[model samples]
Target: MLLANVPITVINRTYSSEHKLISFADTNTLLEICDKFQRPFLHFWTTEQPTLILGINDRHLPNLAAGLKGLAVNHYDYFLRNSGGLAVISDPKVLNVSLFIPTATHNYSIDQAYQIVADLIQTIFPSLTIAVHEIANSYCPGKFDLSVNGQKIAGIAQRRTQRALVLMLYMSIAGDQDGRSDTVAQFYEQGDAYRQDRWHFPKVDKATMTTLANLVSLDISVEAVEDQITTALAAQENAIDLSSAPELLRSAQFINEQATQLKKIQLRNNQLPIV
Candidate 1:
């Protein structure tokens, strides 16, 4: 594995119980910073708020008014994230993990990157029989969707630039997977009326999604799995803290700058008229 040859120097960040938009922006910034510096990073965060995140390629709902009203009814704030996927639901029980690596540094092909991420996940939960394949009825269906016992639990998405690539995945740790799926399904029912003829959103089946708690015999709390992630990372390569590494000080500075830039971009985006 290419990951085995490289030292796991990560800039760790946690956004537990934080706004989804803020965390999304921060993750976006981290990807840029890591790419700019040609460094590898591991980022983990969790969102407590129920939010519906739309993919950039997703159809912009023609009737956003009804979509916004539907979201308000379900107590889900909505936003579009800069990533490759359709609508996905997130709550406190879901844990989002992202890996930012320089494609040139690692000589990574797109397939290789997906394999590395799937391998890392298998490393985290070694006891379980995890299968990586597409779930046709699942929301955000993809070839890299991780499943166990014929149930989809996590979906992987990637964004590749000239120098950097990000493998972002979300795991259903412990939550009402059915309810979350239903929420997204209904949101589409109301929002599907509006279309940009861009991408086809899935007609999600609530039964297609499952959580880790349901799949594994042992406790699979977000914190427990998070600890497992760090442990697994340490076993694979030396994991360092950003503050402790003086030689990589510039990466930290770049992250700060990216945060500021993202805030301004988000603000400008929000100000744009929805047509």
Candidate 2:
């Protein structure tokens, strides 16, 4: 396990449209670092386009064929994530933060992992009235979703290995959050089986979800939000300089080893190949 005072490696990054899979693969790379070297990592990434990332359960959605066709028509590329949670939308306005750390216990509580992120968000936006609870009819419904004034702004998900833990969150920073919500709702509607499927998907209502800009009523750009987050992190903990860290370089090299399987997982889940 990492020493209590070890510096947390912070990576503030954004990716090209084609690097979506590489983005997730990077987190797994950090997970391996935690497992192998007992190091901890923090990552924040922004996507350039509106991408639909579905969860494992999405493969069995009843009208999946229709949904995939609709995704194609809407010009939104899709992929299956290595973590849990239903479908989620990402764009230039959204920020995805993940924490990869070592775990000492065999069974880490899911809520405990989520609370770590929720607490960090509270630290970042101390003035905002943040709430953590499931917002029904919201995309990626979950018990630890973060919201302000009853409208969801972030969703939390977690994945764990025997000795490593990864907690992931997607926060909408700007843009028409309602339109994004509507988009996911439409995907589910197209993919619905007249409620015949054993599993229940969320009934997304745009009003029940919102962006940080909407919540604060400020024209907060995604870049500004990213700056604030990284600044806050730098102030709160020791920041590791990734450029000069040899161990981190090796950790990134590890990602190359896992790339083939990461690419194939989505295809096996019936997702479209990234062109």
Candidate 3:
């Protein structure tokens, strides 16, 4: 995990200092803040409840029927994000962040953006215990997964809109990875297994998935992890703002629109029981 260092260039800013440690109760609120910022923001967020988000182009997910039924989950609340990745595991204990960056080039790629954020994360965990490698056989497998040596601790995704790039992330601070993994594994196992083609589904290694609490050994601790983020940000030349309700309301509206469109598709295909 990389820490913030003052860049010598005047055209750039190590803007991580301007980030607000926002505690969002809903994913929609997280989405809205990204849309409302100027100097770009990296929001460390969380959800009110356990939720599953699918990529808009993820049409090959399997076992969706059994996945929804097995959860006793209400699909009305599920949203299909207009971004990349299949499904991500997110919960209250998890620390999720979205970075809204403005790229001048029209051909900005997700890999380029993920590299910038992942590098910062690697700096904080210099032990290199948190491996910055793609955890294959894992849900939403990507190049930017923050793994502990061989195990996965965090995952990152990219969402862009109107030239604004929002880098979405899900960090398992302290929760049941086995439980989260089960949900994802089960979603594919019982939901729509019959629909899977040659494509592989998100894989979760129960043994490998870990939290910050589980990672702290002797010299490094969870408090250290917390301290580092604060200390690292404080050492920088930036300020963080608390998100407001007005931003939340706008987030809810975006969630509604995304979920509504997903509901229609899920109902038509018998993927979700919401309709």
- Candidate 2, clashing residue pairs? none
Q: What are the lDDT figures for the candidates, one per model?
A: 0.72, 0.76, 0.55
Between prediction 2 and prediction 3, which has the larger TM-score? 2
Alpha carbon deviation, residue 16, candidate 1 (Å)? 7.8
Mind giving the per-residue lDDT tens digits that candidate 2 earns over 25-134? 77777777677766677787877778898887776777787887788788787777776678999888888988776775444687877877787788778889899999
- lDDT (10s digit) by residue, model 3, range 223-250: 3454455444444553433344335335
Better of 2 and 3 by lDDT: 2
Candidate order, lDDT descending: 2, 1, 3
lDDT of 1 by residue, 1-275 (tens): 43423454554444443445666776666667666776677777766578777776544656655665787777786666766678887777888888777766556777888987788889987888999999887988999999887789899988877878888989999878998888877877777633545557777887788998887844668778777876776776645344543344356675576568568647744742353
Report the Cα lDDT for residue 150, model 2.
Answer: 94
Cα RMSD (Å) per model?
3.4, 3.1, 7.9
Pairs clashing within candidate 1 = 62-194
lDDT of 1 at 47: 61
Every model's TM-score: 0.85, 0.87, 0.67
